[model samples]
Target: MTDIELGALLADASQAAAYFVDIHDRAALVEAANALDFTVAAANLAAADDKDALLEQIAEALQFPATFGGNWDALVDSLGDLSWLPAPGYVLLLDHCTDLRDAAPDDFATLLDILDEAASAHARAGVPFWALLPVTSPDA
Candidate 1:
């Protein structure tokens, strides 16, 4: 479950949950996710009798916002849809965001808040937002 894969999955799920958008359509979300310079990492999401193999997926998907159409609020709104699900178990993997805090603290903070809201909404709706954000060491 590389960051890129995480982002794509997030986008796909968000699109479906909120806008009823089809993840299979050819669009910028998919294109930009594929175009980004991503890291290759192996990660997996497990389900009984259905193991999801995310090996070799790019880690750049975390930056999907950089390739989308809208402002931060709009982005938040789109993602916020996850909160409405009956039991949405969405996870976001931020692979290498060591610099995100320093490089763009305000933006990152806003992102955190928005995500927090979504998580809260999900919780209230009896849904769970499972997330992971692994960062490389500063020395790395």
Candidate 2:
């Protein structure tokens, strides 16, 4: 969705299975979220240089349980079984994700796929999950 369409999307979180936001600046998105009524349980991965960094950042930010095994399978299990985030919607902003995407494209793609799957599962339970990221361009 375009930037113009993003704010409304915050209120209407059922847009798609998940969102892979491709924007150069995150300030705009965060500003919009702050100005609006969207209560997001967000995490920023600007410092995540690899898979472990990514997992740890999310686990810390979202307060995942101790059972979170910090692996791909464990990540999926944790995401699909979120009971802590009781917000109207859950937003995960992977700020500066382009770095990780470039360094480990395979892992990044797997992360996106897992995030999308988690979004689908959460949507079924009436909770919106957003996996926001940055791309060079809109279609990237």
Candidate 3:
């Protein structure tokens, strides 16, 4: 399905599913982040009192059609020491990964690896995790 359609589906999905939408572009990302009340406070990543809250806040702020550079370590680190969702399933959308493919291919791959690890960890604990990655033609 198209990103728009996928987004619509996620919006209508039950809370049992963890949903995330990754986008490209800093301004658009900021706009999306704002829309969802997510504060782009990467500066305080290590000190984030609640990563889930941050994710929820950022999810609420996210908008599509934006591009982002992949920060593999940062993204992976963000997932560290986090609690799992209190549901049977979780969904995540890693947007703009394709954009980072050229400039930061290694980081991009590392980010995917981290995402996979997160999914595996959730699954091992009996929770389901899903992730979505968006790519533009120019991205490839």
- Ten contiguous residues with the weakest lDDT in model 1: 47-56
Candidate 1 per-residue C-alpha lDDT over 1-140 given as tens digits, one digit per residue, 9 for 90 to 100: 45566455543433322111222322433343334422222122221111111111112232333343445555555555632222325545433343554555665566566656765665565544433344333232
Which consecutive 10 residues in model 2 have the weakest lDDT in total?
A: 34-43
lDDT of 3 by residue, 1-140 (tens): 44444433433323213223333433443344334332232221122234343333333323211221223444454443233223334444444344344555554455456767765665566544445553444334
lDDT string, candidate 2, 31-54, tens digits: 656555444555677788899999
CA RMSD (A), model 2? 2.9
**lDDT, model 1, position 102:** 58
TM-score of decoy 2? 0.78
TM-score of each: 0.45, 0.78, 0.42
Q: Name the runs in model 1 displaced over 4 angstroms.
A: 1-68, 82-87, 136-140
Span of ten consecutive residues with least summed lDDT in model 3 = 61-70
Off by over 4 Å in 3: 1-85, 136-140
Give the top-scoring candidate (TM-score): 2
